[model samples]
Target: MASDSDRLRALKAFDNTKAGVKGLVDTGITTIPSIFHHPLPLHRLHADQEHHFTIPVIDLAAAMGATTTTTAPSERAELVATVKAAVETVGFFQVVNHGVPKAVMSEMLAALQGFHEETVEAKAPYYSRDSRRRVRYQSNFNLFRSPAATWHDTLFMETAPEPTPPEEIPPACRTIVPEYTRLVQQLGRTLLELLSEALGLHRGHLEEDAACLEGLAGHYYPSCPEPHLTLGTTAHSDPCFLTVVLQNAVGGLQVLVDGLQEDDKKKSDAVWVDVPVVAGALVVNVGDFLQLVSNGKFKSVEHRVVAKSVGPRVSVACFFRPQGAATSTRVLQPIVTNGEARYRSTTMAELVRRYRAKGLYGSSLLQHLSL
Candidate 1:
C-alpha cells in the first residue's frame, strides 16, 4: 500500500485538475490511479454472477389508458400486486409505457450527453462540491472520506418544491429539463400510490406520510481506460423514498438480490443481477427511507454501477425525498408491520445527513438504525 501522505498528495493533484475521471482517461491512463482501486469485498461478488433470473419488467400501458381516464379499480389493484411482489423479492422493477413520452426521454438523454461531452472549459463553471448549489457538476463528493473514488461524474440539481432557475442549468440539456421534470414528478406520485396500496394502506398514505416526491440527481459515467480497476459507482442503497432512473442502452447497472434459500445467502459469491435497459422504461428502486418508513415492508437492496471500456453511459435519477418540515420532523410510521419495529423512529433529515456523510460506499444507514 502507498503511504498516507503520498495518497493524499495524489488525491489533491487529481482534484485540482477539475476534469474528473474523464480527464484522467483523456491523459491515457493505462492503469487506474491508486485512489480509484476498489476493495476486494467491493468486487468479489461480481466475479461469479451466474444469475438465472432476470429482473421483473412490468407493463402499465393498460392502466394508464388512452384518454387519461382514472384507472379501473381492478386494474389498479392488479398493478399494485405486480409492484408489491417485485419490491418484496427484488426491491426494483422496470415500468414500460408508463405515460412518459419516448421523445421527451430522448431529448433528456441528448441533453445529458450534450453537457457531459462539452469541453472542460464550457463545463467548468458549474463544477462545484457544495450540495447547496442549485446546479453543479463534480466527481466523487466523498473522495476525501471514502477508501477509494469511483469513476463517474454527477450533475446534481433540485427540480421540485421548486425547479432550479433556467440560467443555472447547463445549456446542453436545458431545453428538455422542464418537461422531463414534470413527467417524472407525475410518475413519482403514481409509484408512491402504488407502493402505498402494496403495503395494504390507502393510496395516499405514502404521499401524505413521507415526502415521496422531491428532486432529481443525474450522473454521467464516461468510458474508463482502466475499467477493471475501478467502479463507476460503489455498492450502495439510495437514501430517499424512491429513485426513478432513465438510462441509455449502454447498461452497467446491477442490483443485489439474495436467494430465498439459506444456502444461497451463505455462499461467498454474490447474487448480483444485471438490470437491462429497455427502451422507454424507467427503473424504480425502493430506497432506505421507504424501507424504514414501512418498517421493512418494502425492501431496500444494494445496487451499483460497473466500469466499462465502452463509450459514455448516461442516466438521470429523480429522487422523491420528503419536502419542507416533513423532511426533518416527520416520524416514520409503518402501516404494514412485519413484527416489531426493527428500527427506531427518526427524522428523514438526520438519516439523510448521516447517509450523505457516509457517501455511496454500499454501507447502509438502515442497519445502523436497526434495534
Candidate 2:
C-alpha cells in the first residue's frame, strides 16, 4: 500500500505537470491514477437504480413577459412564488428563454473545451496555484486537501465585482467568456431581484443592498478510463448566495433530493436524481449564503457530477456572492421574519473559511452555523 508520503508525492507530481486531466488523457493512459481513486464503497459508487424525479423548469418568458416593465404584476408575483417554492424545497430549478442567446452559450462551452484541449504549452501560462490570480487554470482547486481528486480541470475567471482583464484570459476563451459573463451577470441580478421579492423584501434588496458579486468557473471533465471508481465532481453545495449553471447536452449532473414523502420531513432520506438536459436551459440552485440569509427558509442542496467513459463533458457555472469577504468586515445575517433566526450571523469570509476547512463530501457548513 502507498504510504501517506507516497500519495502526497504522486499528487505533487500531477500538480507540477500543470496540464490537467485532459493532459493525462492525452498521454493515452489506460487506467486512472491512484490519487483519483475515490474511497467510496462500490455500492454507493455504482448504484444501478433509476430515479424518475424531474426538477421543475420555469419559463422566464411567461413569467417576465418581454420585459419586467411590460409584465403584469400578477405574472411577476406568480414567478416569485414559483422561485420561492423551488428554493425552499429542492433548492434547484431550470430556466429557459432567460435572455442569453443559445449561440453565446454554445460558443462559451466550445471555447472552454477548446481552452482545455489546447496543447499543454499553450495553456501553461494561465496555470497556477495562486488564488490571488483573477484568471487561472488548475486541475483541482482542492487537490492537496480533498480526500480524492476528481477527473476534471477548471479555468476560473473572477468576473463580477470586477471583470477579469481581457488580456489575462486564455486566448481560446477571450471574447466569448467575457460576453457570457456579462449576460449571466444580468440574469443573476434578475434572479436575485425575484428572490428578494420572494423573501418579502423589495425587489432591489438582494441585488442592490446586499450587493452580490459574480464569479465564473469553466469546468472540463475529460473522459475517464475508470469512470466507476471516481467522479467528475464530488458532492458539495455551492458556498455562494446562488449558482447559475450552463451545461452541454452530454450531461451527468445529479442533485441529491428527498426520497421519502414530502410530509415525512422528519424521516428525511436523499436519493440521487439526474438533472435532465433541456436545450437552451440554465440550472439555478440556492447556495449556502442564500440559505443563511433566509434563515433556513431556503435550502442549499448537495449536487455532483459523475465521471463518464464517454468523451469530455463541459460546464460553465456563474456564482453570485459577496466580494472580498476575507478582508471585509461586513456581516451576513438572516432575513428575520415572524420572529426567530435559525442561524447565527457571520461574515462571508468566516463562512468561506469554515467551508474551506471542512472541504467537500462532508456534512454541510450549515450544521455548524445553525443556531
Candidate 3:
C-alpha cells in the first residue's frame, strides 16, 4: 500500500520534472497508478508464464464472393462454420486474404514508427487525456482505474466515416493512415456479415445494428534504455463489437488462454502475422457488448501487450461499435429468445457510457450490469 505522503512525493517529483509534467499534461494525472493501498505490481507477460494463446488463421477471401455478387449458400455455410469454430475455440485469430494490401500495412507501420520517433516537442501538442477528442497521445489507459501503471507511450486516433481529418493526424502519420482507414472500414463491414452468419443470423444483420463504426490506432512505443522493467500494454479485452488489430514484425502481443496450475495461464507462441484484409475476414471477436447481446455464447477474451527488448512494437486496432443514434436499444433477436433466458436486453448507449466511466476495471461492464 502506498501512503498519501508517498503519492504526494511522487506527484511533486513528476510536477518538478519536464518529462513528468509532459506526461501529466498528456495523461492528465500527476502520477499514474496512483498511490493506493495494495497497489499491485504492473502486469507483464513473460514467455515463461504458464499461459498459451491460440492463434487461428482465417481465410477471408473464402468467405466473401470475389466479385460484389452475393456469396453462394455453401460458401457462406463453410465460412460460418470456420468463424464459429474459431470464435468458440480461440476467441482470437488471424485473417489472411483480408483485402487490405500488404503495401498499406507496411506504410502504416512506417508512419507510426516515424511519429513515435519524432521529437517529443513535435508530439506533445496532441498529448491530452481528453477522450472526447478523436485523436490524442498519452501513456497507459486514460480511465486506468487500476492500481499499477502500464509501461508504454501511446498515440490514439479514431477513424470512421466521420473521421478526424488528416490535418489533425500527426504530420508524420497523416498521409499513410487515411487510406488504410478507408480500406479497413470496408473490411470491417464485410467481417460483420461473417460474424452475423456465424451467430446463425442473416448477412448484414450485425452491420445493420452497427449502423456506424469507429477505428483507433494504438501506437505502442517501447521503453528505450530499459525495456525489461516496463510493459507495452496491460492485459485486457476489447470493449467494442469487434477489434481489428495490425501488429508490427516485432511481436509481443499475446492472448491469455486456459492454463495449467490453479492460476496458471497460456500464451500463443507465433510472432506477428498479417490480419487478412479480404472481405469477411475482419478478424472479428466478441466484445463486452456482444457478449451481453449473445448471452455469453460469444466470448470476449483477455489480451495483453508485452514490451520487447529489441525494437518498438506498433499495432492498429479498429473498433466497430453500434451506432448510438440510429440503432435499436434491444439485443439482436438471434442472440436472445429461442425459448431460453440466456440474456436480457440492454441499450448500447448505456453500455458505452458505463464502459467509458469504468475503463478496464474488474470483471466487465456487462457483468456488473447483469449483477
Best by TM-score: 2
- Candidate 1, superposed: residue stretches over 4 Å from native: 45-49, 65-70, 209-212, 260-270, 336-338
Off by over 4 Å in 3: 8-44, 47-53, 64-72, 224-230, 259-284, 323-334, 337-339
lDDT of 2 by residue, 182-268 (tens): 787778878888899899998788885344555789999988999988999998898888899999888889888877555554544
Candidate 2 to native Cα RMSD, angstroms:
2.1
Candidate 3, which ten residues in sequence have the lowest lDDT sum? 270-279
TM-score of 3: 0.79
lDDT by residue (293-354, candidate 3, tens digit) is: 65676777776666555466667777777543433354443266455645556676667767
Candidate 2 — number of clashing residue pairs?
Answer: 0
Reference-based lDDT, each prediction: 0.81, 0.85, 0.62
Top lDDT: which candidate number?
2
